[model samples]
Structures are given as C-alpha cells and as structure tokens.
Target chain A: MDHNWDFASVLANKTLLLIGLKNTLVLGSVCLALGLFFGLFVGAARFSGKSWLYYPATAFVELFRNTPVLVQIMWFFFAFPIIAPFKIDAFTAATLGLTLNTVAFSSEIYRAGLQSIHKGQWEAGKALGMSYWQQMRRVVLPQAVRRMLPAFMNRAVELFKMTSLASVIAYGELMYQAKVVSTISFNPIEMYTSVALIFFLVLFPATILVRRFEARDTFRR
Target chain B: MTEVLRIEGLHKSFAELEVLKGIDLSVNKGETVVLLGASGSGKSTLLRCVNFMEIPTSGRIHLEGKAIGSARNGRVAYAERELTQLRSRVGMVFQHFNLFPHMTALENVMEGPRTVLKCDSSECRRRGEKYLDKVGLGWKADAYPSQLSGGQQQRIAIARALAMEPEIMLFDEATSALDPELVGEVLETMKELAEEGMTMLIVTHELGFAYTVADKVLFLSEGSILEQGTPAEVLTYPRQDATKNFLRGHNMFRLPEPQID
Candidate 1:
C-alpha cells in the first residue's frame, strides 16, 4: 500500500531540532573533556603503585563500570538530592552521571597505555635524577599519550554517543528532542530516523579517524 | 685513589630467593671495576642496588663520601625531596640500552641535564651533541632508538649518561644485547670512558673487554662474590671453582660444553 515518508515536518521544526542538537553537542563535548581529565587522573591513581590510591581507584572504577549507566542516571537524578547535602538540576545530574560513567571505562584505556611503558624507562628517568612525577611528565606520559590516542578517541566517540542516554534524566539532549519532535509530529519513524542519521553523521568520520590513528601509531612503532 | 663508591653488606632478595648474598665492594675514583658472572649470579642486582634502582634488603652505599639512597641501618631512607638529586650523581646504562624510545638520541641525552640540572635548552642541546660526539654518535643525534642500530643506541645511552657528568657510571651488561659485530663499538666507547678516568662499574661477560679495561674484576656466583682481584688474577687465573666454571664457557650460553673425551 502506501509507503510514505515525510522528513519535512520533523526537519521543519528547526528551532526544536537546533536546540536539541546544540544541547546534545554541548553536553557531549563538555562531558568528554571532563571525562578525559577524570579518566587520566583515575588511571594515574590506579597505577600510582601506592596501595592507598590504587585500591580505592580500582573500587571506584568497579562500582561505576560494573553498573548500568541508566541506573547511575537514576541515582543522580532521583536519589542524589535525597542523600546529598545539596539540591541539583536535571542537567547537572545528567552531566555528573555521564562523566563518572565515561571516566570509569576510559581509565582502563589509560591504565593500558601506562602499563605499556617498560620499567626500564622509569628507571632510566630515575637514574637521570628525575622524580617519579618528573619521569611521568617528561618520559612516560608523552609516549603513553601517543599509544593511548586511538583508544581515547574511541572512548570519546562512545562518550558522545552515550550522551543520548542523558534524555532519561529529562535533560533534553538529542534523543529527548527527537522523542519530543516525534510526539508532536506523530512520526516516530521520521524523527527517530533523523536522530540516528545525526549520530551517524557525527560519529562515522570519528570512527575512521580513530582507525587512522591506530594505523599511524602502528606505523610509528 | 679516593673512593667514589663504597658499599658494605649489600644484600637483596626477591621473595624467598636471595639474589645478592652480602656484596661488599669499593670502587675507587677512576677505577674500572668489571663484574663477571654467569646469568642469575646477581651481578646485575649488585649494580642496580648501587643506584637505588633495587633497594638493598640491607646495606649502606656511599657516593662521594655521602651515605645516601638508603640509611645506615639497612633501612631505605627515602630521600624523597632529594632523590632526583641523588640519582643525578649515579648514571646507569642497561643491557637493552633503554633509550627513551619517543625521543631522539639528542633529546634522550638532553632530558637528564635539562630536567634535573635545569640546564637551558641551547646549552643542553650543545652538551647533548658534545656527549653524542664523545660516544661517536654525533651524526645520529636526531635518530630514534628503533631507527638506530643496537650498538648505536647503546652508545647514545652512554652519551645520555655522560651528559649528566655522573661521578660514576654503571653498565649492567650494556653490550650483552647487541649484535656480535655491534658489541665492539659499544665496548670501545666504554673503554674510551674508562681511559678518560670516568669511574665505571661494569657487569659483562666480555673477557677481553674486562682484561683490557678493568682495574678490578669481580666474579659473582649464585648471588655472591666468588672471586675478586685484578682482571689477570680473577679472569685469567681464577681461584674459585665457580669463577673457573664461568670462564671455561664464557660466551657459551644455553649449552653444555662438548665432552672432549
């Protein structure tokens, strides 16, 4: 019978789409930056070779990583304000939940990069009279960054995609906007299709870039 | 000669395995002390302990009359604030060369001086070049470790250490990992360093390198000093059975000697 597709109505709601797109991009980018920094710090803490730091960091990673992100979103949005000493908003809840979630997974990537370093490199730096921090800053991290790049970028893409889950907290990211647009337009297929298309448009080149990074790093080796 | 490095009762054990059985030794200023041993004899461990790379289970190490890196009562005194300062005085070259892979030969040499000494960039670069040239690697200053030959990489490592102008140099079988033909070049660089009156403690199996360059030779067997004397005395005319056995098959690794009946 009639296989009719109308993207016109959904796409015509330019303001709604723009707001959603902007929020999604903003949330994704901000959380990504925060996640990367958090991941590196947590990763460093885990491998700091000190039992005090390592155990807690490992526990923290396990707590977040082993749980579903949606549960974390529930925790931040619903449970946090009840248990916490302060009030919060949906956006803050989404950001906090997403940041912690991203940090948990990416820290493993960071740990892998850090572990790839030879013990001799640390000793060489030490013998040259550099402190542990100095060795890390001067010798270890530079090499680790190169090795960690593709994984880190992959994680970043994942982070951006994961921001779609922020809609669960009523934070009004892309997926939320798409849901709203579909509800208003009575066109689930069209609105959702647009949403999927937007994600593909943003993340496909990113995947290719990650692969290129993997290739370049291999060639560098 | 004044003592550059003096160690007393240096002992180290990995779990239940005692890798160093109370090594007592003194290296005089400008003395080239070669540690000769078969694999697992703890020669590398002894060399490592001197620089606090491996904390001695018990010992005192004195560098230039300063008892540092560990306390007198075998307790590790964390010179946490001054560890970098302590490390600056002891330079070590590894069997694998361990040149910072991401950096150029020149940058690897430059790192210690620039970071620890706070040497200015141009000055560090100039000194890096000078030391690279000293080790006959002036032309390869820009090459990465993977790009350079093993011998060339080891030479750059030597240059990296020398750039710091360390009071004593430690070579933990620096030539052991090199290609056979490549071994000579690194040995020659080390020999030149010895002649220039740089105090050296070398762990090596190259008997000829030991005979030619060592003022003192120590033979380690099963984590203890089995023999110690002049190279002619320890290498050529070894007194201990362990030293004799080690010398009989110096380069014959991983094989029983053919029974010449």
Candidate 2:
C-alpha cells in the first residue's frame, strides 16, 4: 500500500499547536519552580540524621517515586476530589501530581549532591565558627550546587517529557491538543509525528548542553 | 604566664572504643606545644575535642579559663550554638587543608570574618590580605584551591584560619598531606607563626621541627600521655618505653644537640 505523506494539514493548525505549546511551557515551568524550591528543604530533611525528619521525608519520597506518574495524575484528578476540601480542576490535579513527582526525584539528587561533599569541609566551616546554616549556605551548597547542576538539568528534561502525561487528564497541554487535532483531522500519523518533532526540537539542545556541563571539569580538585 | 587553653580529665569514646582516656594538658599564652604519637594515639581526637568536633564523653575544656560545655551529672553537655561561638576563637588547620575549592584564596580567608563575624566586605578583604601575606600567599589570593600546589593550599588554609584571629591555633598534622619537598614550605610558615608568639597546639610527626620550635612536647600512646617535657628531655632522653619505641622509628632526622641555656 502506497501512502502520500502530506504536511499541509498539520501546518494549518499552527495556532492550535502554538496554544498547546504555551500551556505546556506554563505547566512545566510552574511545576519545576515549585518542585525545586520545595525539593531542597525536603532533601535536607531526607539528609537529616534525626529520625523525626528522616522517616517522614523518606516515606514521602518513596511513595511518590515508587508509583507511576500516570497513576498519580489519575488519582489526583479522578479519585481525589471526593475527599478534597477544594474544587480540583484538570490543571490543578496535573500540577499536584507532576510537582510532587519532581520533588521526590529532585530531592534525591539534592541529597546525593550534598552527600558527595567531604566531611572535612563541614568541619572546616565549623572550625571557622560558622553556624550549621552558614556552613551549608556558604561552604557546602556553593560546591554541592555545581555538582548538582547536571543532575538538575537532567531532571528538567525528564520533567518536560512527563508533562505529556497530563493529556490523560485532558489538561489541554501539548499532547492533549495533538490528540484532539488528530481525531478531528483523521491524520494521527502526521499529528503524532509533529508532536514528536516538536518535543525533539525543544529538548535536543538542552540535552547537549547538559552533556557539556557533565563533561567539563567544573569542580576542579 | 596566662593560660590560653586547658584540657583536664578529657575522655572521649566512640561507642565501645575509648580513643582519649582521661587526658590532661594545658597551653599558656603564646606557647607552642607539640603533640607526638602513633596513628591511634588520640592526638587528633584531643585536638578535635578542643573545638568540640569530637564531643567528649566526659571531660572539661577551658579556653582562656571559660569552660566549653556545661557539666551534666558525669557527662559534659554542649549547646551547638555555644560551640559555634567557642570554635571561632579556636582556629584549626587540617592535614588535607580543607579549603573551599570554589572560592579564591582571599574569599576562603574572608569567609570567617564575613559570615561569622558579620564584617563588611572591605573589612574582610583587609583581614584576608593581611593573613595571606602572613602565610606568604598574598600573591595567590585570587587563585582557587585547585589552582594551587598542596603546599600553597596549606598556606592558604593557614591564612583562612588566621583571618579569624583565633586566640590559639590548632594544627592537626598540617603538613602530613604535602609532598616531601612541599612539607618544608608549610612547616616554614608554621614556624614563622610560632615565632610570632601565636599560641599553638600542633599534632605532628615532624620531630626535627618539634625539637627546635616547641616550648613543650607531649608523647601520646594508646590514648594516654606517656611523656611530657621540653624537646631535650622528651626527644633526647625519653624515659618511657612507648616514647622510646615511637622515637626510634622516627629517627630519620637527627635531633639538634640540646641547647643548654
């Protein structure tokens, strides 16, 4: 069977695809900002020696990390509103699931980065009369953040891809919009191919940049 | 002479293992005391105890006559906030130098003053420059730790500690990590500090340096002090078998003839 590959239909709906792209960016940025901001504190809690902090943080991380992102999104959107105190829209549910997932994964990255620093660095700070926070802010984080950079960028890439799962909840993100356009135009192949190309175009440069960061000896000796 | 630091009945334990068993020692103002011992002899632990880096199982540490921790029943209880303030007054240099790899030499030195002392950037820079000059690393102030040699890094470490203007400096085998040739530069910097009348408690295996610079020397063995005296008495004529055995292995450098005053 010979099939003609026509690109006109896909290009004609550029406005709709553009709207989908905007929604995707908005969702991805919001979740990333909230996840990383809160992830540091949760990461510190996971790194804490005290059982009070460590146990709860461990449980939170394990629960989110062990489950699938799709299931989490479905649970938030379909099942959560019954006991929920406030109205849960598709965007809110998707944000809740994706942000927590990012938090769980990124927190581990933060924890590992902090752990990689030598104990002597902490002692050096303490010996200089720096408080615990001072040691972390001035000494530990400055060094740890550099090592954590590549890992965080990798997380951002994974997070952007995971945003597609919001389509299951009909969140009107890029993937959801693509599905609607494909069903309406009866061009599943072109619509889906266009979505793949769009993702590759956005993410390929980011991955190359992350590899460069990883390859360079940024944290010398 | 005024006493700058005093440790009395200092005991430290890691679970079932006792590393420092009821040790007692003191350093007066501007005095240089050298601690000699084998690896597990508790010299490092004793130095760490002074800064509360290794919390004492039971003991008392006095810095200029102020007790470091509150005695609770039989054990000493320390508040971390108190320890932070106490540590600022007692600088320490490690074997690995422990310089912040990300910061320049000047920034590393200025960190203590800027963050802990809450000094303005200009004031911190002045103190940073002064100490770097003292350690003979003023020219390398803009260099990162990774860019410097081990000896240069160690000198910068000394500058970083000195920037705090600590009342007494502790050197825990400060030159042990350097190359054999680089060791001399760090030791030279340390000797200059000792000569400048800076109170110092140094744990090192450099017997030659101890013989010349130390006002008092203490030999530690199996978590206890085995001998204590001038370099002449302890290095030349150690009475204990443990001290004698430790010295024999370290006879690579000849001891200078005891200067009879």
Candidate 3:
C-alpha cells in the first residue's frame, strides 16, 4: 500500500476552484430567486383554480416532483434541444432543470403555508372591502411568508446541494472542477475533500440563516 | 327618511342546508337594528348576504334605492366589482376581530380609505387617526394588532370600518372573542356609534346592550326571523313561543313574577 498523500496539489488550483465557486454562487442565487417566483405562481394557481389554470399547473408540479432530478438534468441538457431547439448552453440547461425541480418542491411547501391561514382571514379581508387580489397581496402573502421562511431556506440549501448535479452537464461548477482536478493530479481524496469544504462554506451559513429566521418567529410555527 | 338597505324574500343555502330561508328585512336611514340568535341560527349568514359576501340563492337587495342584486340570463348574479362596492357601503366587524395582524391600528383604519375610497394619503391619515380616536384607540395607533388585546383589536376593527364612512355597518358577534372583562369597552364603543345614529345591524348575545342601544331587535331561529320589535317588546313581552323558548334556552330572558296582594 503506497500512502503518499499530496495536499499541495489540491490547494495549488485555487484559481480553478474560485471560478467554480463563482459559478456555484451565481447558479444558486438565480435558482433561488426564480425558483421562488415560479413556485409561488404554481402554488397560487393550484390553490385559486378556475379549472383552466389548475390542471396544467398541477401536471407540471407532479411531473417535476415525481421524476428524478438527474433525469431532468439530462433531458434538459440533451433531449430538450432536439425537441424545442432552444440551443441552451450547459449553464442555462442546468439552471432550467434546477429551477423546475426547486419550484415543484417549493410549490408543495407554499401550498402547505397558504392552507394554514385561517378562513377568518378571507372573511376579514372581504369585510374590509379588499378585492381578491388585494387580500392575497396585502394579507395572505405576508402571513404565509412568515410561515414559509424556514421551509424556503431549507429548500434553498437543498437547491445548493443539488447544484452538484449540474456537473453532469459539464456546467463547470464546483463538483465538475473538483473532478477535473482529481483526474489531472491523480489525487481523488484530497480533490473531493476540497470540494466538500467549499460546499460546507456555502451551506453552513444557509443552515444558520434558517435557524435564525425560525427563532425569530418561533410562535408562528 | 330613505331606506338605506332593504332585503326582500332573501334565500340562501349550502348544499341543501338552508341557512337563510326566505327572510325579509329592512333598515331605514340611521337606524340601529340588533339581531339576537342562538349559534347556527343564520344571523351571520343574513349579515353576509346583506354585504353580498354570500350571494343570495334568490332575493332582492336594494342599497340606497338601487338594486344590489341583479339577474343575468335568468340566474341572479352579483358581479365581483359590484360586491366590492356594496361591501364598501356596508362595512362589517367579525366575531373573532379579524384585524390585519401585520398592520398597526392606524394602518388597519387607513387600508379602506386608501385602497377602496381612493382618499389622498393626507386625508386618509387624518381620517384614520380620527376614527381611531372615535373608537378610543388614538393612543394605540402605532400598535400592531397582535400586540393588542382582543378587545383592543376589536376596537381597531370598528375604527377600520368607520374609516370607510359606510352608509351602514354590520357587526357579526363582534364582542364574542373578547375576554369577559374586556367586553364592556367594545360594547361602549358600539353604544357610542348607535347614539350617533350610525345605520347599523348587529348580531350579538349581549342582551343588556341590545336592550339599551337598539332601535329594534330581531330574534332569529333556525333559518328565519322568529320575531322582531322594539327592544322592550321583543326582549320583555315576546308574542312568539319560539322566541320565548330561544330566549329562555340561552338564559337571556326572565319574566317578571306575578305580584301577591
């Protein structure tokens, strides 16, 4: 057994690691913001159904939630260009896949949040002369957001971890860069450890944020 | 004086569970009518129907001499926009004191004037403060609803309704949520409103308050008005056995004993 561990090689490619870090952050942020937007839309559409809006949104959510994320990534990267011909790059394909996945999960979280608000809320809004949209915008969303923060933050961390799947599409994010460094330096353990550390650097703070937000509204939960 | 609100042959049901059964009711300009009823007696539903919150199955409602309910393709309909306007005209206070939890007492009062009435910010602010003062919450304008007690929140709700300058106000068991000790403060505010001749319909169990403040008291049972008369007549000398039984069942009335010579 040859025990020759080289930590220097892993640290030496700081530049490549930094590029990978930047890509991870960019993808994570975009996925978080857009994921929430589409997730809220899907959740609201599911809840406020006129049948026309409900079935299609319900199908979209079920399709994304039921399938594996890896399959979704592969489809968006390889098969989507053939079918839709959008000609999306690896980064765009990964972002799209991650967005759809996050939204489906987040939509369920949001539906739970929206349903928890008491019926008295709607009656009170009506009594105040609030239009249906005004009640949702002014009253329901504000209350639901407070209830949804912890779940949203948890899903955000999950989304961050899921970014590793983007590596399958050659997205050049942290995991892909780690694999390239390992292949070149022939030091799989150290290279992968460095990548895991990078993930910890990003994910630990998100977990803390969720804890803090939950602490602030302990009564609500 | 004109009739501010009129309900004729109003019927409402929920999947054959009839809530309001062919009820006829009216209120003249500036009249304060209090409805007394047991739980599940349709008093709340009737109030909701008057504001068009629950569309009547079949009925005619007139507000300020204009029909509030209309027929569309042989089916009665209330347009969403019309319902919004009708609700604005008739503000309501709920049993649980459903104040917007995020807003301060002042902001709760300001929402209607700013959003529905389109009052300018300056006017809205001024009127909101004034109404808060009217409801005895001027000192608590900046306090959030959750920070306030149930009674205080109920008072803010009343002030919020008053901010709309509604031609009529509806109260659906407004004081029921308050701690028994705190109920007096909210009842005091309503009494003040009644004394000022604000056109109002109240659904309440506070027998003493109805006897004191109501121009007329309506007693409801099952899905219809069991009886209606001046407070002294209905609460004291009831003609209907159903109304008498209801009052006795709630332990809300006691007949005077015969004198022995």
Best by lDDT: 2
Q: Provide chain B TM-scores across all predictions.
A: 0.92, 0.96, 0.94
Point to the candidate with the largest TM-score: 2
Query: What is candidate 2's lDDT per residue for A1-221, written digit by digit as tens?
Result: 47778778899988889889889989999999999988998899988878999999999999999999999999999999999988999999999999999999999999999999999999899999999999999999988999999999999999999999999989988999999998998888989999999999999999999999999896465
User: What would the per-residue lDDT of candidate 1 be over residues B15-94, giving only the tens digit for each residue?
Assistant: 99999988899999999999988899899989988887887888778888888764556376766666567779888999
Q: Each prediction's Cα lDDT score?
A: 0.88, 0.93, 0.88
Candidate 3 lDDT by residue in tens digits, A158-193: 998999999998999989988898899888898888
Q: Mind giving the per-residue lDDT tens digits that candidate 1 earns over A126-165? A: 8898988899999888888889999888888888888888
Worst 10 residues of 1 chain A by lDDT: A212-221
Error of 1 at A56 (Å): 2.2
What does the lDDT come to for candidate 2?
Answer: 0.93
Off by over 4 Å in 3: A1-5, A86-88, A218-221, B72-74, B252-261
Give every collision pair in model 3: none
Candidate 2's C-alpha runs over 4 A off are: A219-221, B72-75, B252-261
Residues B1-261, model 2: lDDT tens digits: 999999999899999999999999999999999999999999999999999888888889999989887877776789998999999999999999999998999999999999999999899999999999998889998898999999999999999999999999999999998899999999999899999999999999999899999999999998999899999999999999999988888985665897899
lDDT for residue A215 in candidate 1, whole number 0-100: 83
How does candidate 1 score on lDDT?
0.88
Give the lDDT ranking, best first. Answer: 2, 3, 1
DockQ of predicted model 1: 0.68
Clashing pairs for predicted structure model 1, backbone only: none
Ranked by DockQ from best down, the candidates are 2, 1, 3
